[model samples]
Target: MKTLLHAAGLAAWLAMSQASAGISLNGTRVIFDGAHPEASVTVRNHGADILVQSWLEALDSDKAELPFAITPPLTRLPAGQEQLLRILYAGAGASDQQETAFWLNVQEIPQAAGKGNVLQLAVRQRVKVFYRPPGLDGDALQAPERLRWRLRRERGNSWLQADNPSRYHVTVTGLTLLSGGKSKEISRAQMLAPGAGGQWPLPADTANDARLRYQIINDFGASQAFEARLQGVAPAQPQRLEP
Candidate 1:
């Protein structure tokens, strides 16, 4: 078991690092190949000697029990030193046609402060681990562009509908609607599972002939942009944006 420890949001890394006591992770996210026996991640300590802990948790409590195990969950990491964390999955019958995600947690437990009134904070880094079954259809990296999009109106409110027909999961980072020289940003951080769909609210005054520009989180943990023209699109039908 081995790969990157993918953080859910990069901003979280910045917020936590301000404390000046933390560990550095090697990757933005983890991709666990189903056919492989294990995945690995590199964890490095930047401060004084401390005890580090690593574990995995199910993304959804309603889902099946996590069949993954992380070795050496507890270890002592010296200052300026790093260790390789290994992950082993039991292949818990995850969907053969789609990818499943989990939370990979690595926490820092610093040695007790010697002085009185000293505060010791244990900072933990949480990232996503995508378990991709072997031989799935389509390209995972291109799934975001392949999504079907449409703008809909309901009860005086406009909504943007996104339908992902691909076999991989896609995480959206940003969405903006541009029409008639007006641009409106929509707040939505979401992950679309294969063949699943979601909707986001749009400005009530959105133009009929609008242009939609959005960004999706790529495998490398960066935002990739896509643009689409939304004019004369039927409310009930999904359409792919112009290439």
Candidate 2:
């Protein structure tokens, strides 16, 4: 029989929450201003002594790269103490046209093993990091309200395409698609940046009379709901069989 610390068991434990939580990040999101080449994030250990590992991942990449560097990538943070991790961008993948985003993951691992039948799990926390380029256009706070939405059909599937024309990122949550007296909601949160767009799969019939309602995550991480109907979008027509 495999113990709870086995590979599979550990994987399951990683997915669950531990009672003795210790690590916390300063901000829900990190912004890397273009004018500066470095940014810092503060990590606080509120419970027991633990080792925290930090890394950065591109939005669509599976692995973390070195365009950015974290000071003391792995460090032991004592209880009630805090560590400031500096992030340096070498301009490796920087784009002058629009803003780019990445994910910052901080994992906390306990340092001591208690003598008992106690289960301890490592806690991993992830946050978004936005790299803003100079002279992109518009204010970050107004970006969400400037977003444009459309309902489209491709390859027999219906989708909602959200376009962000500003230089700032607009995080959307609680999105719902309403049509034909029926309503469906998005399962996860989405974020769109300047000149960037994302497609959310929707019901085929919903394309005909689709209206989208969602909340935008502001610079402070607060959600504000808004509703709008897709504009300049044509509904998909069902194929007809020839007799």
Q: Using lDDT as the measure, which candidate wins? A: 1
Q: Estimate each model's TM-score.
A: 0.85, 0.78
Model 2 lDDT tens row, 1-243:
567458878766655545458988988989888888788899999887899999888887775563777777999998999999988888776777777788899999887686877667778999988888867767786777777777877788877877877877888888887776778989788878678878888777674656677777766666777777664384322121122
Pairs that clash in candidate 2: none
- Report, for every candidate in turn, its global Cα lDDT versus the true structure: 0.81, 0.77
RMSD of each: 8.6, 8.1
Best by TM-score: 1
Candidate 1: regions farther than 4 A off: 1-19, 232-243
Q: What does candidate 1's lDDT look like per residue over 1-243, in tens digits?
A: 122334444446656655577598998899988889888899998888999999988888677668788988999999999989998977665778888889899999989888788546788998999988888888887787778778888788988888888888888757888888988888778888889988888777877887777778888887777777776344332233443
Give the count of colliding residue pairs in each prediction.
Answer: 10, 0
